[model samples]
Target: MQKKLIDDSFSIVLGKQGLDLAKILDEKKYINEFIIAKKMNLTINQVRNFLYRLFEHGLVSNIRKKDKKKGWYTYFWKIEKINTLEFLDKEIKKRIYNLEHLLKSRETKRFYTCERCNIDYSEENALLNNFICHDCESVLVLKDNTKEINEIKKNIIYLKKELEEVEEEIKKNKDFLLKKREREIKKEKRLKKQAKEKLKKKKINEKKKIKKKTKKIKSIKRK
Candidate 1:
């Protein structure tokens, strides 16, 4: 379900082709462009273009490495899952805000429409025009807000739910990253402690060897 949401979000940003790329790129690993191209049956340049588009939106990340023998660079790409999800979340919020504003306007304001001309006007505009259609010369009818209001309300509800899910996914990603970082830090500290102990042992062994050599030298002199 999370994968579907992520894919749907990517598709919204990158179009239908974005869904294919989403499947090809891994969030955990950077994949070679050539490999991605092969999997998608696209040219390397085409793959780069798609990845670059994603890069422009900060949805994807890339790393380039120079080939040792060829001296040319190869690009590897990966999806920024958290960034993508957050982007969708912001978009959803914006839409919901706009829809709520429209809903309020629909509820509070009066609107008229000319059935003949199929043009709508607010009460202010209808009064300005004497409540008549300028082109058709017919009296305007009061517009019904029920359908439009219900539709907007439904959209707002759906977006709010989607926003909640996206936020949940973002939190999960953050927690996973935090735990991974903690493990890496613990491993680094353990390695550093071992290195310090090994160095201390080496110094003590050197000191013992020097003391033994000094005793032998004194004994030789006495003999």
Candidate 2:
């Protein structure tokens, strides 16, 4: 499901030319940028352009590694899964807002259409055009709100459904991120505790050695 969302996300963002870039990034951590270029069969610069776009969006991250052989720094890249999900969620919410605005306008305002040309125009635009079809030279028809409104309303419903699913994915990704953070926190705590315990044992051993030496010295004095 996550991969599906990732794929869906890239497809949406890249339109007709992109694939599952998130999956490609996720499969290898800190992957060399050149490797991505090779796999995509795109020029290095093209891949860099796309990756930079994702970087600006905060959907991908990178680290630079100096090439031992070439004496130049090269970057490695990976997807920021949580950020990608959040980005998609934000986009969906924006669309939903636009849809709601359209729905309200459709419910409350007037619209006109050119029936013979099957062209749609806003009421203000139609009025500005003098309610005449520019192409057919026919008078504009007062659009019936019933059929088109129903279709728009249905589209709004579908968009809302998709928005909810995107929200759900965001929630799931957030939980995963939180859990990952917690695990790292716990691991650090555990390592710190072990270090403290080791120090405590060393102190105790040192104290024992001191007491044994004092006893031996006192015994030698008494003898």
Candidate 3:
């Protein structure tokens, strides 16, 4: 379910080709762009174009490394999973809001339509037109909005479910990143402590060597 939302989100942004990209991009490690192009059976330029689109949306990230012998840079890309989910979340909310607004308008106000011309107008517009079809001179009929209202309600429900799933995925990704960061912090502290201990030991040994040299010089002077 989480994967579906991620894929759907990408597809929403870049179309069907984005679905193929969602499969290729790794979350943990950056994949070489050339390799991605090969895997997708697309030209390098096409792959870059897709990556650039995703990059604009913050759904993907990239790094470039200079090739020492070739003297050119190679790009690597990875999916920004949480960012994608967040984008999807915003899109779903926007859809729901629009649908709700439409639902309310449909329920409260009346609409008129010309059956022959298939043109729809709000009650106010119909009033201004004197309840006549401007094109065919036919009488305007009241539009039955029951079907539209029901369809809008279903769409709202579907989007809400999708939003919930996307939010769940976002939380999971955040928690994983937090734990990974904590582990890295712990490792860094341990390495620092070990380095401090090694330095202290080296200093103590150096001091002992100096003291022995001074004693030897004092004995030789007395002799």
Candidate that scores best on TM-score: 1
Residue pair clashes in candidate 2: none
What is candidate 1's lDDT per residue for 122-173, written digit by digit as tens? 9999999999999998999999989999999999999898889999989999
Candidate 2 per-residue lDDT over residues 1-223, each given as its tens digit: 6776666666666753446466567734799888888888888898888888778878778999898999998889987777777777777777778877887898898888999999877899899999999899789988888876788778878867776877787788788779999999999999999999999999999999999999999999999
lDDT of 3 by residue, 70-178 (tens): 9999999998888889989998998899999999999999999999999988999999999998899899999999999999999999989888888888898899899
Q: Where does model 2 exceed 4 Å of error?
A: 124-130
- Candidate 1: 10-residue stretch with minimal lDDT: 1-10
Candidate 3, which segments miss by more than 4 Å at Cα? 66-72, 116-118, 135-137, 220-223
Measured by TM-score, how close is model 2 to the native structure?
Answer: 0.86
Error at 140, model 2, angstroms: 1.6
- Lowest-sum lDDT 10-residue window in model 2: 15-24
Q: Rate the local accuracy (lDDT) of all candidates.
A: 0.91, 0.80, 0.93
* Candidate number that wins on lDDT, 2 or 3: 3
Q: Is candidate 1 or candidate 3 better by TM-score?
A: 1
TM-score of each: 0.88, 0.86, 0.86
